[model samples]
Target: MGLLWGITLLWAFSFSLIGVYLAGQVDAYLAVASRMALALLVFLPFWRPLPWRQALVLMATGAIEIGIMYLFLYKSYQYLTVAELLLFTIFTPLYVSLFADLFARRWPKHLWAPALLAVAGAAVIRWTELSEDYWKGFALIQAANACFAFGQVWYRHQSKSTSLTHRARFAWFFLGALLVTALASALLADWQKLPVTPVQQGVLLWLGVVASGLGYLGWSYGSTLVSAQQLAVMNNMLIPAGIVVNVVIWQGQVDWLRLGLGSVCMAGALWLCRRQSS
Candidate 1:
């Protein structure tokens, strides 16, 4: 559980860096395709190959989490600003919890407070990112968030009985599924626009190997240690709350009021998480 939270924070922050770096470079389809290919290569050796069941799950998971969700998000950047993208992302958890309830049939003991606090924090984060055109990005971002959040929980469920050794049972499924999704993306998108710069290459490397691979491993293993409700509270890391603060700090614009607001948001998240854990 501790490791899951720790890695969650790191991956959340790293995703922000990746998102900012990818700004205006390419569409989400190509971006996800390129990144997913690399991720499959990295994980290919883990398991010999995948069974039909695992392969299907991986493909389905990739379609929702990467293909449909991310591709739409990429298209969103074309229409909306970053601020709007972040705001709509806050709503994703609500969708995830709904999926969890329908599938898992319950939340943690008392999750409404932290859940509500997390929603408020999302509102504050959205407020910070608001723009006239950013609202246009809301639809895609919201879809991406819901897909990702639900996919995470579903993926966890799929791997529930598997061992967590280096020989991960899910690796082949994840890789094969990603490969198919990437291939479909290639058929649908302009593949020539890929292999752009060293920055994109490096970002894809990090996203595939570290963020998607290791971060997911952490999330999967961590979920085993924590309750679904706890996992939901921990999912707050998706918002990149800390990275926003880091950006503000880097700019040398010290606004105590905004900082205090962010701090309150963090505190609420923390308090709610603690309550869930207890």
Candidate 2:
């Protein structure tokens, strides 16, 4: 849990950095590719060939989990503010719980009520001012959430069956993610919008080396140390941490009433899920 909390703190500033420094300013694919490449480098020294089957599974998980997830996540900043982005991510825990159950082939009948509550929470945010751009961003976030949730569930299960230490096999994960992002950058990145400013370059370096490389390794290892219920709760912890970082550090304004109400609804969902799981 300490490791997870530390990674959460490390990641708290990630959304704001991307929103302020990379998103819309730098090409999303290029930024994602750069981050993945640098992150991959961190684990490259530990690389050893896993069984082909294990390698493929880990690779596939990385592609969906971080690679494609980042694509959606980075693109989201074009439409959503840091506050709105953080608020919408409140649904992630619910997705995590749902996906875990699905992979286990068990349906928890009680999950539906909390799921609806979570959706209501999202609806409560800016419901009066819905627009195409807002909905697009929301959809992109949900997609990223699903990818991340699925990957967490997958890795937690997959890691248990593997014999290699986390450091020994984790590079395969980043290698998989790198392939996806690198291909996307080659095909779709905007060459004209590369990172130019020192701040942009520095942010990318920090995000790649520390926040992503180390943070994800810590998170994946920590996920193996805790209960699914605990993991679900920890996933949501990033919300308040991120919102506070965005608000206090960046002076990002949030619609307090809406944020409060939405947060209550989302919190209720988490509580209900926790109660059900327990």
Candidate 3:
């Protein structure tokens, strides 16, 4: 729980930073590749050999979750506002709950209500006029969300021996992500649009090392400590947290009434989940 909360705060600025600094100026594929490469490097020193099967699984998880997920996320910034992007991610909790139930081969039965409530709350937050690009961006973000949710649940449930710690094994995860992103960048990115400004380079470094590296480590570890229901509810925590960061740093205008009301609903949903667990 502490890990989740800490990462929530750390990640609060990530959306705004990407939207403001990297989205339009940097080639999305290149950005993704660079970020993953740096993160891979961060974990490489601690890397240990794992079974071929386990290594492959972690690699696939990273490719889908971080590699492809970032592909959708970065492209969506061209079409949607940061607020809309965050709002669309409200459905992630539902995806998380569904995937967890599927992977477990039995429904928890207690997760549905809270997950639905969280979705409803998120809908309320963005119930205003939308641009024509809404549906496209919405679909893209949903794909990213589903992949991310699946990865988190899958990693959380994996059985491992107590030999090497998770940190020691995480390099394979980022290595897989790097392969996907690097390939994508090589094939799709505009070489002419690489980061040139010092600020751009610095932001990329920060995102790769701090956000992708440490943030993922904390988030994945945190998922193991909480119930699936709690994890589902906590997935929505980023919406409000990101919004607060956007408003404070970028001075983005937000609907306070809607934000307050939606936050109440989400809070209520989280409370319900906690009560059920108790």
Highest lDDT against the true fold, candidate: 3
Per-prediction TM-score to the true structure, in the order listed? 0.81, 0.84, 0.93
Pairs clashing in candidate 1? 83-129
Cα-based RMSD of the predictions, in order? 3.4, 3.1, 1.8
Off by over 4 Å in 1: 12-16, 19-21, 49-51, 106-109, 128-136, 163-167, 238-256
Candidate 1 per-residue lDDT over residues 180-258, each given as its tens digit: 5666676777655664788877887788777767766667667667655566656665554455545654442334554
Error of 1 at 257 (Å): 2.9
Model 2: per-residue Cα lDDT over 129-167, one tens digit each: 344468888899999998998899899988777788888
Q: How well does candidate 2 score on lDDT at residue 100?
A: 71
lDDT of each candidate versus the true structure: 0.64, 0.81, 0.86
Q: Which stretches of candidate 2 lie over 4 Å from their true place?
A: 75-88, 109-128, 132-139, 255-278
Highest TM-score scorer? 3
